[model samples]
Target: MSRTIDERIVEMRFDNRQFEQNVQTSLSTLDKLKRGLDLDNAAKSLDGLGDAAKRCDMSVLGKSVETVQAKFSAFQVVAMTTLSNITNSAVNTGKRLVSALTIDPIKTGFQEYETQIGAVQTILANTQHEGTNLQQVNRALDELNTYADKTIYNFTEMTRNIGTFTAAGVNLRTSVDSIKGIANLAAISGSTSQQASTAMYQLSQALAAGKVSLMDWNSVVNAGMGGKVFQDALVRTSELLGTGAQNAINMYGSFRESLTRGEWLTTEVLTETLKQFAGAYSEADLIQQGFSEAQARDIAQMAKTAEDAATKVKTFTQLWDTLKESAQSGWTTTWEILVGDFEEAKEVLTEVSDAIGGVISETSQARNELLSGGLSSGWKQLLDQGIADEGGFIESIQEVARESGDAFDKLVADSESFSDALKQGLTDGVVSSETLTQAVHNLREKMTGMSQEERKAAGYTAEMIEQIEALDKGLQNGSVSMEEFTEKILRPSGRENLIQAVWNAAKGLVSVITPIKDAFREIFPPATADQLYSLTE
Candidate 1:
């Protein structure tokens, strides 16, 4: 059993091997005879087992979990470093602005600076919370969002207070607008406002091209950290501007002249707040973009495998349809007779489906075994607990396939062109493994009505199942790939090769390959194994 001391930790209490085997046995029995045990409950139990394993420090399963956690840790540290840099920049900039607020010999900039202080504070808070890993980052962002909502609200109140200073907002928006407009006319950037307008238009066009939808701007001040911030900024900016202007006016004996600077404070507030808002978005965007890039390669690889498997499933279904058509024609007088005519075609096809289903079930089991230590269990555990990023193409394909049957249809249709190109060698000569498999099942169904004697007369036999098992074994033992095995046993190799190629590449180190000769020998005899190998060569 290759039992290890690690397996004993927090040991399943139940016999580890016996319990797992029992679960599989019960699952198989249900699937074979009764069918489809609601796996969610069982999967949950498996995950609990994983957690237990981890707590006990069982090396076998613990190692797999630790590996995933380690990768997450690595990503986290890098992310934390990124956050640290951003935080330092924001903090330094903020303190300088604060100093300006305090040191303004005239005390004039204080009010406008006041509106922006919360924005900096909000950013600092978010930066403080953000972690390096996905889970932690997400939680931190959630907290940041709470803070942001308040910050934005603070700016919003500041805006309303500053709203009396529309002249200021207009001037600021105009300055930005003018530059953009001229840039649009210039086709990029220029010295003139007209050219700048062109640039503005171009930027607008670019924005329009992206098809963005607008969310209400006034949702601020309603709830959360954003509202609190806007409230703070609103009170402070307005108070500072009003107070500074009144003091300046009273001191300078110029009441009306103070309004211009007072109004200008509004512009200052809006501009600064907007920058912080954008910065918050920027910080989050940077992290998520990085995360996506990190995760993308694995996602794309899985998608590719899924695409290949879909084609195989499609080909099998298509071939079954063709066989159906063939049965209705001259070569085989009737559907019933055609089925019986092919000997054990009906049984063969059924076996193929059964075989594929079995593999799926077993793979699920093995994956569960590997990840038997974590919060995740069963399929989730296997998927989440991968030490190496490449999680077998089949696993990816199956994950994708679990989503929907339609994807396979598209894959199959796309493969037709490839199949046609290698028609003799791959398409016609090689035959899709899925198609042949489904064909055998179809044959079984088609032959079902026939009596025992008729089935024998038709040429059907149990030998085919034996042959398939032999092939499966070969593939399992690192003997021959699905491609080579399919190419030898079935014609029209396109789907098989595509699947094998993807499986090998996508899985990287996970595939269990079997020798072709030994594979066939398992089904037939030692001699037949060599013969099959030689034939494929």
Candidate 2:
């Protein structure tokens, strides 16, 4: 059965081919098993080669082992590559899951949260650059989320209030710090956002109108008077002065100081007093000038009596012209008489006659009557009254003029009644001798005083006293209201007594009716008692 050399060579080549094919098959099975992570199946497939070897010729065994060893080395390379690819894919999926839960919601919920997202991105980048662990990044993200939620809530809540502030010329969103400050102010004041907005707006308007300066505004707001009460006081002061923002500010200061001092002056009274003082000072200056004494006196009187500055200036000018003309005529007449010129005297007399007619036409009845006929009538009255003529007739007239000016100055400075009377008389178009006399009489009466007991005896009641006291308090506090006084003080005191009487009557009625009720109840069941009560109703 032994073959020849050529046949043996051919058969050996066939055996080598078969061994290569089996090794290729085994490598393919290992590839599949490695993909499935079935290392045990791959080992068992390699072990199965022993059974295949028993069937093969013993001569080819060395070649078969060499071929199988080469394929197994190839299989190890494929297994490592597959495991690496799987690990990379799992890491990518984990990252996508984290982004879907956290980052996606922030992007969708708030467009303004872009800045917060950028902040978080920077944090993550820094953490990665520093080689931080996942736990550190997670902690940082949690803190950022908390801060972002709070910031968004605050911004949404104060949106309307911020709009109001912006309209009033304040920019709340200029910085994160400023926005936080506004939130704190709202919280500390215990004010609703709308109320804070309204208060700030009103304060801004007051400043713009020059009703109060910035410093005063700050003081008033800090002092807790930032609402309607503060606004009303500023408005009232502006209305009264009618000019000069500074003047209003000064008046407000005085008004508040007066309240602190317990001085109760109505706005009307305070305004009138200030006007009178200003007018009096102006008139005093005119007298010091070389104006004719009578003209100066009339100027002072008009200035004190007129309601407005324009009216005061106009009325004074009119009276001054009349007095100046009469004074010039008197001087001309005196000079002519002194010169002993008969012809000049006649000319001067004619001029004086014309001035008298002009004076009569220009003045009210009382002043006209004083100047009737000529300067002679005025001189005759002065002589008849025994007024000393230490100088001469001309000097006597000058003296009389000086005395009239002095009288007006004294009336403004010393007598409040004279100032009030003069104002009333001028307004009524009754500025005559009788009005002046009455003003003097009024001044005298004001100087006299009455005790409280005397006032009460004269018919001032307890209720009237209470009302007066309440009004005084209200004026001092800048809350001038009769209704407030009646409700807060008068009614409360009086109602207490009335309530007590009513309560006593109710108790007495309960006692009187109790026995009759008991007698009915003794004869009747509870149902009968209910029926009896229903009958009464």
Candidate 3:
């Protein structure tokens, strides 16, 4: 490649250029190799970082699982405690509900009240069916119960006696009256009412068949005493010695048989038989025969005549005859029984007044007004126009009072008067501002006249007295009507409000629980929600 001087320089330059090019090529190759080695080291570092990232991810996953398990355990504890509390509360509430519903005294009272209501309804319906009025039926029943209680006989026994009389073609009213008459005779005769009733029934049958007459035995069994003869004879026989209780009962059977056979025996025959038989028996024997020791001694004395024997024993017949005579002397009809029995009439008056007064004093303005105004007016009219010929002054007053009382009872028992709509209207009228103010003023005046001791004795508490005074003050000051004042005082409060609040809350809780309960019901067995809801109510 070298030449002569110039050629040599050119060749040398070429050679240098060639050598420099070679050097540059070699340096480029070394730089390329260094770049390859750096790439490999970077790749190895990236592989190590990926492995570390995988380990960190596994550690985080394990920690998350452990936290979930710990939280689940805590939730289980809280859930179990809450569920246990709910179950215990439900069980206790259920027990209390059952106890309160089943065994409370109020439950018994409600049951008795329902029974009485049903009985009243039945009686009403029965009265309608029997073509009888409720007042008459009720009066008859009342008389039956009253006499039965007085005579120590069950009312059913008297009713059965009535049935027997009615079965023998006697009308219902007559049967009832006859049974009552028999009961009265039984009380005097010291015999069971049933015995007297049975005897009377047999006599009724005999009279119907013409086996007996109303004008038999010295007119003892007159028209007034028609069906009552057997009972009267039994009563007289029971008072005779040697024919005391047991023999008198036996003698009644014989008399009844004699009537059945169309044989009418005189009341003297009963007396003569007792005297002849008693003449042989000692006082002890007569006592054993059911005569009292005094009666036995009198019978042992042996009176000369049946009249003398009759004078020894007190004759209820005279009293019965006096009652009959009173009936003839202007005290006719069923009212005749009440003649000469002022104490009995007074008792009846007291009972009737108390019952009617209680009914009249209830909240209905119609009833109260009728009691205070109409009834008073009617009574006044009756008293003013007293019947002069009817018995005497007392009898006339009794008759008028009875008529007024009966009219009042009919008014009170009228269904229209006691209707709910009418009652509401009456209540509204009575509770009006003007009426209540007047009522309060009147009540206050009456109360003001009484001493504190009188107020307390009348069952007014200290708080009630204070409230009354406050109400009066409010009325006088025009701050309130007495009605409004009373309404404010009596408005639901304290225990009542608390009870209402609790009930409302319970109802709200039930409403909220209903949806959840229904949802659960779809998944589980159905529960008695209605029963539970009723308990809640």
Please give the CA lDDT of all the candidate structures.
0.38, 0.42, 0.48
lDDT of 2 at 455: 54
Q: Which candidate is the best by TM-score?
A: 3
RMSD of 3: 35.2
lDDT of 2 by residue, 174-266 (tens): 212222332223333333434434444444343233333444445446534344423333333344435333344365574444333322333
Between the candidate structures 1 and 2, which one is better when assessed by TM-score? Answer: 2
Which candidate, 2 or 3, has the higher TM-score? 3
Off by over 4 Å in 2: 1-154, 157-183, 200-250, 253-537
Writing each residue's lDDT as its tens digit, candidate 3 over 1-537 gives 333688877789899999999999999998999897897788889999898887675777788999998999899999999999999999998886555434442443333223323333444444445676546654665555444433344454455455444445554455555555444434433454346555555554643453333333213332223234334434344455322434433655644443444333332323222233224356787678676787666555532222232222345643433332222222222332542122354567788889998777675766655544332322222222212111232232223334324442333345453222222323444223343345444454555567889876766556554555566577679875444333432344344566789999999999999999889888986558897898899
**TM-scores of the models, in the order given:** 0.13, 0.15, 0.20
Q: Which prediction has the highest lDDT against the true structure?
A: 3
Worst-scoring 10-residue span by lDDT in model 3: 381-390
For model 3 the local lDDT of residue 459 reads: 60
lDDT of 1: 0.38
Q: Considering lDDT, where higher is better, how would the candidates rank from best to worst?
A: 3, 2, 1
